[model samples]
Target: MNDLELGVIGNCAVAALIDRDARVLWYCLPRFDGDPVFHALLGAPKDASDDGVFAIELEDHVHSWQSYVENTAVLQTELHGKQGSLRITDFAPRLFWRERLFYPQAIVRRLTPISGSPRIRIRLRPRFDYGASAPIRTYGSHHIRYVGPSATIRLTTNAPIDFIRDETFFNLRAPIDLILGPDETLQEGVVETAGRLEERTTDYWRNWTHRLAIPFEFQDAVIRAAVTLKLCTYEPTGAIVAALTTSIPEGPGTQRNWDYRFCWLRDSYFVVRALNRLSAVRKMENYFRWLMNVVASLHETDIQPVYGIGLESALVERTVPGLPGYRGMGPVRVGNQAYEHSQHDNCGNVILGVAQMFVDRRLLSPPGHEDFLRLEELGRKALQLYDKPDAGMWEYRTRASIHTTSSLMCWAAADRLARIAGHIGETQRAGEWRSHADRMKQVILERSWSHKRQSFVESFDGEFLDAGVLLMTEVGFIDPHDPRMAATVKQLEKVLGRGPHMMRYEAADDFGMPGTAFNTCSFWRIDALARMGRVEEAREYFEEMLKLRNRLGLMSEDVDPKTGEMWGNYPQTYSLVGIVNCAMRLTRSWESVT
Candidate 1:
């Protein structure tokens, strides 16, 4: 199956969607950040067809359909047969202690018969380190071992599994059980099997969903988006990844692939805002603490745009030469190089996130935390380079430019610095930062806005419409109803809007290359319209964009308008945040109208 054709299956505890052909397309084994055990999706190796590392044949099945139990993450898939039906329910349960702490590892997939008893076949192929390492497997009663370089996977099945050369295959006519544990040694039949695993998974998700302060009319969509966002989070660290799978191409047959498994500083900012909107302020606060910890340990100059789940800074980009790119997009790469790029927007993002934490309704003060001091020092450093050209928010591959949106972010950083100083009674420093912020605003207004075009240009000299301009109102750089914003909105509509969806920009006109239409830009347009009191238009557009979510209510980085296929990385945290933020804003706007 193609990338877009893959299906998803999993309960809130643990769920994975097997394709129509029976390949585990996406899964986070042991923990969400653990290296992939089956990563054929990245790309097929040169020896894939011959060596059979990347190819797996599916059993002939009549039909298949998958769904989650209502308000729960427990996923159920029914496979039809000539005699009867085979059903599989998957979940990864949260083992809460007396303290109710969350554990990170454990994925359970249970297979049973739902209708007339039919024989079900199962296969276990374990590939470690993004399919680069092979493990030594030893099998015994209800237990199997696959040892690798850094980690070991112990597979246990309730039923007998036939051992092949390296893979395991078995047939079951009755209910069978399976357990996959990572990094831990396993004893035969050692785990206490919960008779009500499925029920517990259902209750876990239902209770979690009940906590959401959902006010939107489209309640289901909002809940699903929120769940997808939760699924992408690294619960232990409070770090949210950009997406689940890596190397999902942005364009067909292109090398615009990236590994999004790591947490991005920019994404955490949005996660905080989204969780706060759901009235789950504690989680957001935990993330703020995580951010504080990250910044506190690093020098002001050592701050990176992204970091590993453990806050590791050694993110050297390297390509897996043997593995082909996803869907023939060559050169599967891991470890982002953007970490090394001079993305000035990160400082602004950190400042904004910190300011939001203080301003949020559920505010908690981190006593004696050095992170805020470090962040303030970095903000000051960023101000020193306010006029120097640097990579903008988009992180374009070419030379840096004086991007207007990035400059606006710098203005936001200084503005927030001023606010933070005022909160701490540092009036002198606050005034200095306020003066710097005013200077940036003046420079942006003078150099970024184009009177001839009657809108804000993409950069200092480029004459084009950039959907990022919509952020001006959101970031408080300009009034939402300002005439300049209206003109910019008009320009965006004329240039970037394709029906109800919006592109990041006219890629051909500005970025010099065409790309898939960005999904988040659509949300920005909705926010802009709602802020401008275009309530009716904003509601209509918001509803229209909601139609683009996948059957599982997940969204990618971009979309293919003609085919309605989600492109880019799957389950993108930014897209989910956009959905939640826009929906919340739209709901509030509608309330104002009523």
Candidate 2:
């Protein structure tokens, strides 16, 4: 029996990283956020004989390789056997309607054989809702239906397939020709193939990607990074999720797992900044509108650090049992409880993003004029808590403290409010805000800095270096070339820096165990260096940071330098924004130097 390792069975979706032997190693389906239907990536199933898992086992296959089409989302995997070669292409069609109005659509996988006569096998096992539900599969002439509570998966195969109760198995020889279409038509409860779905999907990406006017240097990498960022966005809410999947371990079995499929206020701001650099205003404008909506709906004291795709205010975290985690990192969790915590930087982040839009793009009058009122209201709330203790940028679940970074953000919020108020002719309010901002700046400089250490501390009472200090320059709190700013950067590099990246801060009782170095902070260091005229150092560090991107030019929340594996969440939005910002900064620097 030839065991092909490249078979992927996702919850109602089929995906795989095909090997030379035509075996699949990684795949999840139905929705990118859905649970594993075939979970071999985590661990082997208890009952391997059941068809409920999709995998390929072929022995004699020689070589395999995988690649994505340039500047596109299509993934292609190829396998070479003694007799011939086989290729598989995978992509999800971009739907016409927005996510709120339409059900999640289909994922298309196409297989073609190019060489000698070799036998191939295919299996599909689907577990729904984080592998908590097992769907019942019913076979048809051209399709197979897997039905479970309120959700239905229909698979259409161009070639013949052998059907089992909850799985589908099939075999093909070299010169194989087959098209696999898996649709998750949950609300509608029916799946149909349109005459021009593929054509439209290809066209959608081609047109969308072409809008990015990127420099020729590293053009391919830049486009892929841009596309990856787009995939992480929740179209309906204009909220970009931090990543596609959660619970992928930072280390082998460390409990550092956290859910990342929700929108973070901080990440949203960076997303806007990144998109703004590309002159892609529609998405950023939509997000700004979403932010305005959030601010409008929130009570004075009920603003959260994060929200869901539907703008749900509550996020109760829960861990799933029975199913093991990715790479044996147990206790996979869904829903983030951090929503209840106070992240002081969030309001400041929002202010900074909007201010950047106004200053850089001249978007003084966004489409919905009412959004300015919402922003003003939110700024007022943030001002009220300027002196209060709360969670800082890193959501340490404990009693609030006057985190230095938080205080800095408060200053940022005040500064932006002053500018915005001035722009809108709120002369009296603008004056008050500016006065308040000056006071906050004075407070941060006085209380947050540690004279003995000659650097800013993490909290008012602590004497530790925080990676967040890198932002002092980025946020314009201090000039990058200032001796004080230079000293702080030196302190962070000496204390928190791990190789090329920097840790958030030293581990403390308030925050959980500090794990790997954060990727965003690493880029922030590059940004700081660039702003300080350390152009060569910034360029070198930026290139080193790019090495952390996965095969798909995607980045995670953190990384284990020793192993080079992604830690924390996969494809973090903040990380991508860092990449975009760093690239743009480097390009700008080059233009200036020339």
Candidate 3:
């Protein structure tokens, strides 16, 4: 009965997912796309031979509860056994120190007794190179180092070394600290370092969330979603990952699983947009720098749909056969092949993502004339290929179409560049960009509209309906009040909506058909409905979508609409961004409270 019911804890450098029973099921070392140190999440079915787990087994545990410490990424899980009860606090140390962000690549766990004496067993098994090799364990007086083929990690703790080594049960009389991090000795005592980091990390998150201008309604859900999105961001390179894990299937045996641990420019656009709406501009600022580097590196090459977190352009896709996939499905992909595809919409997304930085006066390092000049290159590229064929946003491997999604985004690119040029006093440049946008708009309107289907089709002169085109009103490409906009929404829901959840499309692609509902498309539907003045209907659908989230108010990339079961990658950044965007759109204004 394994599911995506998991809690995430990270310091933006590293992240891990812990199940309801407090097992660290998924974790990557050093960085987000690095070797998975804990791979139990994609291990053998039923965890039959899971050698990548770090679990604390209570002797007679019967019940448990898990949640994030309010307004923070710190996770608190309590376990109740026949003998007694205990609480586990998990977080990666992150805080501000010496005027710099001091977020180490570490996972800190503190065990505290809650009731009568509870005994627990520590099972610390780590793997390397996608579970291909096991680590050799060597113990010191107060630490145990797990040495792998290429890397090593040490568990510096105050707990008894022999008890952890032999997987023996120990009494829960007081608090103990266990820090898993770089293979090095602690500068301070284990207790002092963990305690100091815990206090500071908790403070850091609370202060961060407190600054967010969240909607009055659904405040808790919005904060949680915002925190999840931030955790998915790699602070060093400022590249935001699509999700934390790889190879979680979109549907049972669909073999639709793909690695989501890298940055997709398209997804990054939505993530920063949502965060910007909440006034959480730090992410956008970091992303602007990352995008700057990405753009600078695109010398004589077309922009990729995705890139490695470290800004490495060639993300050669491959499978890791050593590890069985989620629920026994195979083909655990590592790098994303979308890096090789020509997704034309990405240029528009990049422009739209950074355009705000030009207008916002508050950004510390606003883009200057040079940055705008760099973006104009993307604008030119978008206009050149706006009507041409590519994979589209869905990343269809076998087919290429003049996708309306691609065209609309290119239109967005031209549109934003024109506006940016005007704001920057480049009137002549603005006029030229404006003409490019207007011409593309007319062509898109003429070619993408389907009189036969009574709606806007997915691609040029194509009748297949797609959820991607629902962005007409979202990116300011079209007014919501336009008659065609309403018809488009109606037709999309008719063909793609499964109950309240929306599928990416009804048309089949390389995978035959998409079985599960794409969560972000459903949120887009809510957005379209709200903008069309169907506020009540949008609120109804939004609530329905919220129910689909796990107990921790977290969601994945897709879900089983029929059974309300979550599928796909866990804690998807796209899905979390949806929660923020929809809540922001639907919630009542704070002035109403007064």
Which candidate ranks first by lDDT, i.e. highest? 3
Q: Where does candidate 3 clash, by residue pair?
A: none
TM-score against native, each model: 0.90, 0.87, 0.98
TM-score ranking of the models: 3, 1, 2
Q: In model 1, where do residues sit more than 4 Å from their true spots?
A: 5-22, 28-34, 46-60, 163-171, 183-198, 298-300, 360-371, 424-429, 507-512, 588-594
Cα lDDT, model 1, residue 525: 90
For model 2, how does the per-residue alpha-carbon lDDT over 228-325 read when each residue is reduced to its tens digit?
Answer: 77776666567766666667665556776777767788887887778777777766766766777777776645778888756777778998775677
Rank candidates, lDDT, best first: 3, 1, 2
Best candidate per TM-score, number? 3
- lDDT per residue for candidate 1 within 1-594, as digits (tens), equals 235554444432233545544456556565554566666666444544222121122244688776667776666667786666776766666544356743435656677777775655555665666666667777775678878777777766676655333444334466766666654544334334533555565677888889999865767777877777777666666676777777787767656788887778878777767877888666676677677777776664566788876677767788777666666676777788878877777778778877765545546654232555677776876687666787777777667788887777778889998887777677998899899999889888888888888999878767877898888888889998889889999989888888788888664532355457788888889899999999899999888788887666667888766666677877788888888988888775345755
> How many pairs of residues in model 2 come into backbone collision?
23
Report lDDT (CA) for all predictions.
0.70, 0.67, 0.92
> Which stretches of candidate 2 lie above 4 Å from their native place?
1-59, 95-104, 163-195, 356-369, 509-513, 588-594
Prediction RMSDs, each to the true structure: 3.4, 4.7, 1.4
Candidate 3's C-alpha runs over 4 A off are 44-48, 590-594
